[model samples]
Target: MRAFICAAAFILLAVPAWCGNIRLENKKVRFIFESRHGGLVSMEDLGQRRTISSAGGAPVWEITIGGRKVTGNAFSSFTHRQTAPGRLVMTWKGWPEAKNKDITVTVTVRLREQEALSDWHLAVEGTNGDQVPGIVFPQIGGLQHTTGTNLAVPNWMGELLANPGEQLKKPGAKFEWFYPGHLSMQLVALYDQRGGLYAAADDTAAYRKNLGVQLGADKKLVYYMVNYPDQTPGRQGYSMPYNAVVGAFTGDWISAAELYRQWGEKQSWCRQSRLHGNKVAGWLKSTALWVWNRGTSAEVLEPATDLQQRLGLPVNVLWHWWHGCSYDDGFPEYVPPREGREPFMAAVKKAQAQGVRSLVYMNQIQWGNSTASWKTQHAERYSVKNADGQPASHVYNIFTGKALTNMCIVTDFWKNTYAGLSDTVLNTYGVDGVYMDQTCLTRMCYDPSHGHPLGGGNYWVPNSGRLSDQIRARVRNGKEITLSGEGVGEAWMPYVDAFLALQVSRERYAGVHGWQAIPFFQVVYHPYALAYGNYSSLLTPPYDALWPAEHRPANMLQPLDTAFNRQFLLEQARSFAWGMQPMIANYKPLLATERKEEIDYLLQLARVRNNSLKYLLYGTYRRAPRMAVPEERFPMSRLSIYAGQKDKVTAFEQTYPTIYHSAWSAADGTLGIALASVQQRPYAVDMQLKAADYGLGNSGKIYLVHAAGRRELGSYAGGTVKVRFELAPREVCLVEVTPE
Candidate 1:
């Protein structure tokens, strides 16, 4: 075996070696490259005393060009040179015959001044009808076979791959981000017990290609970029300008997240000022109630008002299925059903009189089949087209058996329609704002006729921002009008006041391996925009009465399954801890139904978030410190509702010590902590609060409040305050610490 290994290494190093080996070092990391093979041999995290590299003979860069597999070993010549202090550049040139013609490829790898990051660029010349498929880093070692090693990717909310080797063997096992869908964010991180590595593609460049991460057959991790086809067939001298940041960190996933956060902050989209000021902030502090009533608009008003009065909290009411046509039956035609405009407007006025804000529903992407505008006028000119030039449509309402063709956001027809809807809802309907559906959730359109990029690129993100600005400009009489969408994406931050944040849940396909869902999105854009829990029974059913028996869809009404009870409460607790506004779906029937205990649980959680709005809504979120606990158990289950066989469900365990705790500091420099017990049984959590941990003096007094009964838990003073507190099942506790 040793002799065979040595022979393979010798064969891989057959090319001329300009420089035998090159070492690039900085204060944080050290990277070693083999010149002859043109591959990274060693990646060392200096502080953690760990090396992340394969056994040997592994190629760092692999590409498929001109129907030929080209790897680092395929290069006939190589040169390594130090361009600047702490920066090294390795260049490789090669020629491969395709269709009896030589295709020249030049690859450059530059280790940037930041020791943890490297930039790879490829240039291809003399291409005669030969296409470039992708470029991949085939082997990133120390990411597999380790006990604590995990892979983190931004999938729905975020995904963590714990059992790397086992996970890779699953069918269709890959993290893909192509344009036009839920791939709003592009980032991946692999970390272990010792340290971790973080990598992210340039978002601007990634739109032209597919960015992804997968595991090879040998169990090594791989990240690759698949280039798009040339617009003009038979074109030559194609230069794919793709760049990535590869870095090493010493802690858990948060350290790697910090790297991406710092990069995102410098982007142009994030720099734009938000649309609304204090009014938006006030809206963020309120809990949102999502109503999908099949009844009259007047029927929704009383329930929304009662819920606000009962909870003593403001509410943002999102009214769905209130249109004149059937549910999701028509788009850009938002006339009220049965009751018509007068009753709908009256309902909105009554809700506002009771201090409740209403937001009418609008579908941002879809042009419904039932609508006359789509059938008679703009389907060809406005609808999105697939790769086969077929119109893109989705079955938004399964029961209706109708499909809605997706609209190209960049088109003048869509812009004008959306702007008109915004004006009608805000001005005519007298609603406070618009709850635009699928605004950030839909995939990018590849409609060539729309005059945007062939596939989705940076166009959609900024265009959505412009639409938000246009709507805000039409706010009548300085009424606090807010704009919110289905989901949160970094690009929509400046435009949107809040996001439904439906991705943060215990559903299937949420993550990989035994991954636990964390506040990764909040860590980046918490104070900038508010996130609300998805409207579902997982938190609280939205209605006051039972679900209408005859009209209920078969899949809509779930069985009284006791198995998910504990998991449901835990998800709600996590939402509050992560600084998101807790929301209830279909509240009218829910409040009048038999689920009184569930309603109480939701109210308690809401009160906790409401009382600590200063810290959670306004202040910046800090990473929850690792707590010492006894026998931590992470449970996994099969998803009851799964689209494919590969889908699996994993439950997040927020037990004592590490119990769903989020720490923050308010504008007044007062440190606060929100903690909760998500289990079915009560738990006594021992907490050690250090003043210095919260940016305070060595000594201080920490005040505690139990949000359930609005009871004061007393104050303790010292440099380190050790306190033991008992919490009821699904109970939340809030603490405020001040330096004395």
Candidate 2:
């Protein structure tokens, strides 16, 4: 994090990190940007009486090209002037005629009431239109690091960092989030009790980007976004096709989410139809729990069947590792199943007959180097190549040393084979759907023969989205064949029926602990996509020791002999409260007789969800009212497969409330609120609801909904309605308010 100006020519501006001479304001917010009429400076929400940004910060904008770097003030010339009443245009040029080859950048800033709009354009006139690591524009700096200030990022599901300066400033803390992969969405919120600031790259074209707000050395927060422009050979210029927004609001993270949704709901991808338009199979709509299993029939079937019988709910098991070759080593060589074709097909039929729907797993991006297709199909010709002509490869399985090359899906072979393989799996195995792993995550490719930009371009996202549509339609065959993936992203929402969301509920992994998750994704797209699976964790004591070093967690914490349901109940309750399908992963460990208590709790949650299908599946997810309860500290441990069968693993001191709650509004113009108690004993819950606050209308009747049935509480014409109740251990409590 360098200061405002790094060059000697701009030494005068370096003393005070950020200086602003122009003032822009609306009734709610006051903004001061551009020191000498240039660079973003400070912001204050007048209604909240809080300043969202400080005075010291880095350069407002910067770019890198062909290994040369420059800032907004380092372009050898700079000028700005008012273009309209609330708009300003800034220009920079006069590059030295060396490797620079004469590049220029223009930025247009406009203040629309409470929000600020920043748009950018870059012109390249030389041989250095490549090697653009990233273009940092609309760089906002000087956010004060305080106790209550929090930052929310839209990761796999969503990640809410509490006191980022204190928690995220340590070494190894990940800061940057790249979209269409780790980041499922393009919005983030910086907020506290007073109010919040919302910022997003509101682009409909779906370009890849790095968005983050890190705690710098001085503890000052710096919010920024890295936009990768088209770095094609002989390209001349690139202009932002959309506006980047920063606005001030008077609410929590959910309020910030609604701002993004205003523009998000209108996008072409969502305009096609929301999730309730039956984009998924009829069975998938009512799916309540997902069981995740890998390996052969011996490892998958028995436990999956047991779980389905115990819960008495629709169970969709995502089965992995059925290919003939070893796990993670084979590409599409899926014939002669490892369990023996006859045995495997029989196993699928058995599970289906027992009401267990099977969704087969296949990696979408990788083509194993050890497979025959690598050479016979000429896949090496279309594989993603680095600048040095090496295959962009990844290695996870330790069985074979051969790597898996990321295939370019834009080719006919990649597209046809993916769809063809899925189609065959459904017809042959009589499975429900094909779960494509890592379909939304993309890599930079440099193979010019693929008709894409060398090393970098924005062609991957939209093309992959279209490929999903192709695969879905091919496998359907007039049936409700669903297309599922490992993760969720906005571009693929309209096409894919469901997505596995393990990253949201996993409290600790890869030796890092202390994760606080929020429902930022569901707040915006809960109804647009069906989310399931939290991986094989919680009561499941088995940890894969063969996992790669960087990914293996320190096991030994999950001791089966002294099994406890503390962590299990908390995580499942979170999944239910957040509107995700409650998942029970790796049913082997969960099948232990001592774990019957945990399994029964899962059954209770399933029953509750079964009764409220309309709200959980078809209703809009609303923000949960703030609940402040006493924290319960629990001790948790896990096993390490890579280290040893029994090495004493350090237990992370897990802290969470015993009660988890969520809210939703149904299409029938009613509100539903659910709360679950994960404590071993009992606890009392007291909360008040305002009709106007939750959009429950001016008059409504309150009713209590339990597993057995619904019971009337009372009626309220206006103002607040007080409801108090006590929940038994692992109890799921529901409240319904119907308009009069």
Candidate 3:
């Protein structure tokens, strides 16, 4: 680590005043602060020779207390001193009165020798009755020039805002997991041609409030770190104990992600995934089949068995709408099977015999208004309360106009209800697993009556985990039981064995300014939890027609079927590249239609994914170099042409190597590369590889395995091998390199 000490640069006397400013410099970056206004004057990326802040702009720290704005420049007195060798502390006292309160703000900035990152710690203390609504930081005015720049906002199921301000703005979006709800990786990055800037919080406790980013009317990007501190009429302080890092990197968006990944790897939360070793390898062989039908015992069993036989692989049935009530009509109430418990168990047992596991679906977040108990009992007491003390409601059945009130997971009533329900389901049905819907999808509760804190904290995650554990303990001895959730949530990773990932499909990337969906979540938690890919029914005509009208929500919009099918195939290929299990729902309805090509494509991908289980499923994911291929390879399909749609199908055609590649390595010295083609036509991709690239010697054999069979591509002679192969449309190719 390199260090620069300038003892004589600033006055060392008691007042310590050469100028009312201080500058901190490192090898890669420089930070200049104004003492009078307590604002960041400039942040210079020395390597790029660019400054992120404006000449005389407002400081990065903007505070709002009790609905009143308090700018750092409004403070009456400002003082600064060097706290440590690489650290500086700035304090401001006697701020202008806001919301009838006297306030003080303190900020600490630290820069390390070896890192291009700076850590910031902020504290706001008040002496009167006032509550804090939010805080903004590192206000870079240069972000207004949004020509080549991109902002990345992390969401559950790994969605990002690649084109930030261009998309339709929805303010107050909640980013959760450590703070509450689900999918809280707790990092945001902005990048352009001149490197990038990454900001993140390591402390989950201070991050409990709702966090969001918005493009202000001034065109500057603003961050909202919402907090709900109590308004006590005494000297009280709201302190952020965890340090926030704002770092610069030289590259594109991927480089920004790598910086955050490095910081995330050091946190304790990233290391808690329980799935490792043989457990991860076993999940690769498993495929999930979701059934959403109101049918008799035989109606469900026949199709599940057929899929198992057709695929010639292990399949699991995630049974929905098997109860007596209408689909999603009742919640916290698992009705007895329509035909009877005996027949239900018979169907489950029959499927289990054919290597099919049955998992019952239960709603974990809402209390159905249609339930008989809710009408008679005081269910609102257990529901989530907003800041205004009103219950939160979710409309589940739009046709019938039935809604479910969101429940507070921390309540005793919620815990008892789920515990009893799980016992009945597990012990009575003897199923292999349980699928909990909305387990971590909803926002945190601020209900004061829940016996927890007044404001939201980390109570929701641990309480939800306890509920999952209580249910898992009910499985009979010697029988393996799996716990699955609706979507991926980092806090729920330790409790869930699998996630029905609905966000990994193409529909998530369908808008004009929509982001290019990637498997970032899998890159972090692939070994810990198995993510089952979801397909959009809007893509396949027959599947879309089969959707029940009563079950369809108002927000559901159907895209063109032909264009959807094309993108759907590309999404499946991407999913496989990202180490996710293929999930096909409404199996019976879709199979009855004449969609043989789509079915075959799905089966081939599934077979290949299971076949290359060792590398695709268990190995750690690494970014692979781009493969060179022809520019204009194939023509656009006529199927994409539709009435009232003048837009050219954004799907790639002639692009070289239209294949997604993921590199991996295992502890047993096994090196592997998995590739999935996004192109619709058969094409050959040439890969240039060297043994040293994978930590191998000059002599080694590389085997290319696909549905056709495994064959030796060639051996590396002078430490290099140029392998060429043709992949069928939507085919997955696994290359295994063994050293001699």
Candidate 4:
């Protein structure tokens, strides 16, 4: 055994004292470890004058062994060394009071040669697979938040805490979400006006783990991604298959996102993805608007058809509640439409014949608690259960609050049944597509009988993916059809044709400050899959109000004013600028008689998208050009339309950039910078674009393209071009650049 650099610094030694803090450095960052307990002592960016890490008071790593939990500080023995330049090796052993002397953990940190970051890895020795739950590595403490500092997390539509330190101190802030599920991406970063410290699990395989962004003592942030070992019995010692990245960057989340994009684009999920292969259905690729409606032919079919003609754009009707059974209380029984089989089917056909893609809504996970099939068909055998043996259940019915059990997709019986249901919707119902709700949701099932791991493994990702494949090959029968889910989960990007980013509405958790919803999802996956929709206001028929008070349009539509209308336009503009196909939810005939200004703007946006399809629809998302514009905040409220519940909701001010701008690049070296006005009056914008930054040469032709027409803005002869323009009231336009 190698002796410590100093005796007392490491252990009692049973001898004279001699020890010192072990320092390891690379060109990008330097790390110091306290030999006494191997805690992270300090970390400093080579370019900055301050330390980004806190004092050496936190454990270097943590793990669960034989159902017993321990940390690096729990070990009585430790050793460390710089095995090579820009690399350090630390080992911890002699834990559990000699009960598991065979257990040992090794921590390795390396400064990447070409990247300004440190690569981390961990290997555990001597443990049966099931005996070890997971390992938490490279834990960083003392991330104190400051002024203008923000924390970026991959949650719904990508969340940004404008003031993270203050926000985390607020009530009801989530500490962590599992990767590729509750957490959309596998990374977290704390950044500000100065620089950022970024951490991510750079595994293309996308191991299941908790990307812990928890609150530490003294109002600090602790970031550690928990990596699970395969739980199969008798498996060998676990070594991290992918490197954990911790690095320093010079900008905001977008800069770190670029670094992640480098690794994300190469995964099988991205490489073989339909978007990357350009295999997205032509109908979806050309689609610019979605009209989400519920109910029979009168409420849905008529309005959906009219909107297509009115907007003069392809429209999709995502129809919900066409079946005879109660919306949330019926499972595996969708035939005999609400109005009748013939009328509903005919409406679907007529809408399709008129070019309105009809997508029926189905919740794949929920099985009504009182459904007959649950007992007669022995559906309990195919449902998910917790470790305590309770079924996973939810109550979404607004009036009744009835519960539904979640079905396990990994089970063979459920998979066959689900696909068979989809087949009926496609063939018998005659819909063009199926919007599979909850497909992107993750569940931790402990039912070993389902032929998958009990919990905390990669079972959910591939099972959900393979089921989509089976539905296409079996249910869809190789036809080009859209399969969509609720939110964007990175693992599902390659499997489904589209994902609905309803979070764009920013109405869910209103009243919460420091919350900013950005299009970080579209930035990463717009090209990989079509993302659209939000729980914006509905346009239900006045006849909807004629229904029972509890089951009426009044339940969905909120008391409105000009401010809310302005907010709606801003949201739709955001969806468009962020590269998402715009969605109008719950459209009813009553809408035709109201909101004329909003309707006109919607039509104009459709035209703009159609004209710039090469860039806005299918191009790559580059960094959005910054606009030092005035901010606008409109009073807003949430509606429980999607959740099928009617109750008091979050109310707050929705903020917007009065003049919005976004940058995109087409495959042919054309850069499209979109600009829109959220105000009722014209807004002027004068900005500069660096040609070479977007891969454009010094000289290029510039044009201003709008839904109505286009006009050349003359040619630029330098690397930077300054363009000045004023957008009309509620205008949506694109500034295009092409090589001369």
Candidate 5:
């Protein structure tokens, strides 16, 4: 399709407006636009000669080298605000009438300080101060197509078509929400005509650059808690048992304390969920444990065996439907066979005994099923209507003798159904949480035949070939309610504590590099981190499954148990722990036993560090990056205590050969260094103190370095200490030597 061009690149409201409608204040500019014609529209930073874009603005804006001069209208002023240092103009442009005649449009942009934190608010009012709704500002040269009615662009065209909604699976599709900044940080929501919502950007590539500043990519913590709807809807004050609860992800964050406060609120619903809130109260500490299951089937019973056999620990189990079932089954209505439930419950009992909680899956909305037939009898309306004004059909339900339609979330009937079902599941069946699925698909429905419940039209709905306002509205409202695939944009942060899953690319550094750029951009919004792997992680195309010994027809990397996969498994475990992001293993049903073991290890690790694993996993810690202490204040050789003057070190353990970079402070600190061993073979390490490493920066003092038993070796360091065995392969010896 040809690009859609707006008659006016930027048009302002002819009425009175304030701060140019920039929500955060002067630090950032807000572009609230509706695209009728789509093409690139550039916002040039005159001083830096830099630019940002919207729509099809990439040709002229995204490229840093030689590019074509953006054709079409010259930029015009919509509104202007005069600030102390400079004048902010809410600007736009219109197609040139004749070769060089100056275009009449000029935007009046205003900048103001954000009332709250680091954010700056910007607003672009019309020359006459009139407000414009649905204004979208693509960075310089972004593609602009004839504006569709939907608010969000379809997933990026890496592989998917421009209109992914029309396709069942958006292949090679990357969905980025409204990011109108140098550092694309905030994720925008797309509200659909069907009265549903979706957070478009939740992955690494999309989140790093928000509102501009380029932060170095480093994995940060992402903690998420799942809060179910009050089975009674508007009513408050009912409680559910802990066992009836559902799924959640675990991780660390830069601002964990504040996030924990927000988590407390989302979980407020759990109070009415019939849970003894006290059980999870200690969740704040590192010792709190939780479980995430790859598939929800009869085999879930194994969770009990694993939980009891191991630590006999308290855990929470998030049971999900098998892959084919997650999409094809009729959501909550598509119950597994009765035979499956018994074993599922038996596993739940096992988890409960081990202090584990189990949460079941609930559909976000019914898709594929015909609304007429299913709605007529399903009693509980849980399906959404499609663009054709009919409920979509199911590929699986038809094959399984359970053809069903999708449900509509906007309808009172559907809302009531959720309350009834949730209440019954929690109270009657003794469940804890409801793991709602597919929240990422919320968008607008343009079927005029049905009454529109979410008044403002769906922003996710498409118009001609572009996004529409109806879809945008649906995205916004959905933010007001639930969290799903939508990433942590500044706008939707409050509603989402974490993401359901994190999908990433295969290349490690590229993936991690993209993630590191988040902090310098936006901090208010955060989402749990997740990445892709053919193994446990969810794969779009079926991946090579790890077969059990009996199932391995041909030799691959088949492990006797899952022990062979330890390297990658441990790395992943450590990554989640270090970056402060939670790990969700989306493995298939056939490999539940192995996946469960890894899950057990992760939960145990999380429990040890007061729920803070970034230090153990990533090792590149910030908050208090460096420290210095006086030698006199140092503790004994076997001591584990704070070394710095601030006493910031909560706990420590003496180990070996750990690489301490120049980042450590040694001014007046301890006179000794700690090392497990220095020999290639089994041998004790002893040395005299030397100040050479610290140079003149350290006070001239010497001390003796003692040695302990040798340990095993690993690939990274290439040597080991003398020891019969090293339970934690990652743990090394502490080399302690003082000044000479």
Candidate 6:
């Protein structure tokens, strides 16, 4: 028995233990950012004296930053939580071990106030321990493939990380602006497989050789090398050629709270806050609703007139569509007007009179096929060749042996095309703005036939100065143009005012399992299959027309159905739009008719959003009224959205009762409690409102109230209201019981 006990004791002692240790000094404070004059921002109060220490065990850490601490703990990686006013605390636990020691770990916090965009860096020395040195890179991943694969790989081979071997080294790293509010940061720490006294020697020179930084179209921010200990300048890693596949830029210790805050502040319009709208971004102050149509002369004219009649002056709407083969269309061969441009120019005149912004679309590159005489003449000058040395087919000039098209935007042929097109639109049409579509296809051509004498392929390929020069010319032509396209990744951030990102796959959903891994900085609109029943197709022409002309007969009267939880769907869309960044409506098959139910629902939601648009435009947003996910232990039962008080909101249930809950006010009027029903069915909620709720009543308008789609409610003063809803599988109902 004694021998057995001794053996058990030995076994227990030999088992591995995994944990982390963290220490915070008294002088430490949370980092904060604020805006300065001239549309510029700065990071300040970071240099406050602070001490950080850590012990390594597992390779992951739980760090939290907040204005104050709370008794009920929420584990959010390593972020600071705001518990009270003016107090900030950052906490971290469970970090990986560093090199050479039984316990590898060290933590250092830098407090610096910098005016430049990329001004922060951190470095760790070779310490005795088993901790893995890690670095946090900034910037939403680089431009993604339109194929819906979001891997941050570039089009060119040498544009990004060239040698993985040198990535894990002790070479010094630098940070810079890849796009506005997006950063490019790099760090190096040795990875240890075993505990030791001195970490293995790292070839710092090799690591430095691989360093590279990419700026946006415009150099909006200056690059800065942060001064820190244990960092030396040496070329250790290889400088990749352009268009290389760099890994995705995942947020490390830094939380995106500041990004959210800035977005909120920029959303203000008409002196009201509109951040609560379902959709918003870095550009638009709040969500607004109006009809949209393609750029056909008849359609643009009719819709512009109709919208102006209903929505008042300054229509603030869009006239979208390109008359010729669109950017998405298979061909991009530039064709001059079949007629003398009389009809198209007349359409532009009518649209401008009605106060509409007309956006034209066209393929940035030429299709190999020559549909027009001009295109046939310039075939050799424009189209990329296929692997067989033939001109590429379909919409692409397959210069890379791949099916994708490469635009010779810089070639003399392209310059002529653009100049002619600009002249037609600007001088003759008097259009407000130009929408250059699908410039996103700018990439390297791999085919030897289309290769530049200097070896240019995609935008990522190491090239002669030709491609860059062409880009400068297109925008420099003295006409105001709004550049847009799908998957306009970080690589193109600086050039475009709004980013039309394509959230194509299931993996791209903001609610997906690990959605946090991807970031959308500018305004981005996710495209959904309208006919798939997930979203309302009200904005598009009736779905019956969606099928190919030969596929089926049209079904025009689908009797606008509000019963499909249309209200909640709009809310979800609005939320997502604003949540990601600046963006525009991406409804395809641009519809002709106005689905009034959908329009009213969006407009009401917009009314609420408009109130706080200013604050939301420039403010950071937290995923609030917390969304419940499968991985979570507790599914959300109830939700209450608050701006300031409880009085303002339109509450509703759009789905199964199991998915939503009702709310009740507490006795002291200080709290609102939301409860979810256990069963999936219709239910009623009783709410207590404060005049300040949702910034309503403050706006002095009778706020719109809705639940599901059958009913509407309004409130003049703070009071208790009973709300009922018909729940759907997954839906959200916004309430505006207050004024605004």
User: In order, what lDDT does every prediction score?
Assistant: 0.62, 0.70, 0.62, 0.75, 0.28, 0.29
**Model 4: CA > 4 A from native:** 1-18, 66-68, 128-131, 170-174, 230-237, 475-478, 508-511, 538-559, 642-645, 649-651
Candidate 2: worst 10 consecutive residues by lDDT?
A: 8-17
Q: Write the per-residue lDDT of candidate 1 for residues 288-388, one digit (tens) a residue.
A: 33333334565556667777776777766767656665555567566644467887888878888888877667888778766787768756678877766
Q: What RMSD does each model have against the real structure? A: 5.8, 5.4, 5.5, 3.5, 17.8, 17.9
Off by over 4 Å in 2: 1-20, 34-37, 55-57, 97-102, 114-133, 167-174, 215-219, 398-401, 508-512, 536-564, 589-592, 626-628, 638-650
Assess candidate 2 and give its lDDT.
0.70
lDDT of 3: 0.62
What is the alpha-carbon lDDT for the whole of candidate 4? Answer: 0.75
List, residue by residue over 1-740, the lDDT tens digit for candidate 2. Answer: 23334333233322232333556666667767655426566787777777888644356677776677777666566665556656656666666643654666777667675453333333334434556656776677777767888788888787777777776677755378887677888887887886666778777877777788776555677777877776566665567666677766667788777777777778876765436566677778777677776667766776777777766777778777767765566777766677777788898888878877778888888888878878898888878887788888888664346678898877767888777887677777667788888976867777778887665556777777667777666664576666787777777776678878765445424333434677777888877878887643543234332334564444432434343356667778888887878776666644456576777777788778878877777678877666666678866544322223334444665677888888898888788888888777777767777877777777778887767778997777766766666777778867888878
Over the stretch 1-740, how does candidate 5's per-residue lDDT look in tens digits?
Answer: 11221222124333122222222123333323222221223332222222222322221111110112332233332333333322333333342432333322222223324311111122221212111112122122221121121222212101111222222123332333323111123222212222111112222211112211111111111111111111111221111111110011112223322322243324322232111222222321122333344454333435433543454334444544432233344444534423455665555555556555555556545543433435465533333445444554445432234454545555545555555554444444444445445433443333343344221232221120011122223332122121222222222222222233222111121222112111311122112221111122321112112112332224222222232233224334423322333333333333345455454444444344222222221122223222121111111011111011112112212121221111112223322222211112343222222234333223332222112222223111112111122223222222212222
Best by lDDT: 4
Tell how far residue 493 is off in model 2, in angstroms: 0.2
The TM-score leader among the candidates is 4
Report the lDDT of model 6 for residue 28: 21
User: How many clashing pairs per prediction, in order?
Assistant: 20, 13, 1, 3, 191, 123
Superior by lDDT: candidate 4 or candidate 5: 4
Colliding pairs, model 3: 633-654
Say which prediction, candidate 2 or candidate 5, comes out ahead on lDDT. Answer: 2
Native-to-model Cα distance after best TM-score fit, residue 135 in candidate 4, in Å? 3.4
User: What is the C-alpha lDDT profile of model 3 across 93-112, one tens digit per residue?
Assistant: 77656654357788888997
- lDDT of prediction 6: 0.29
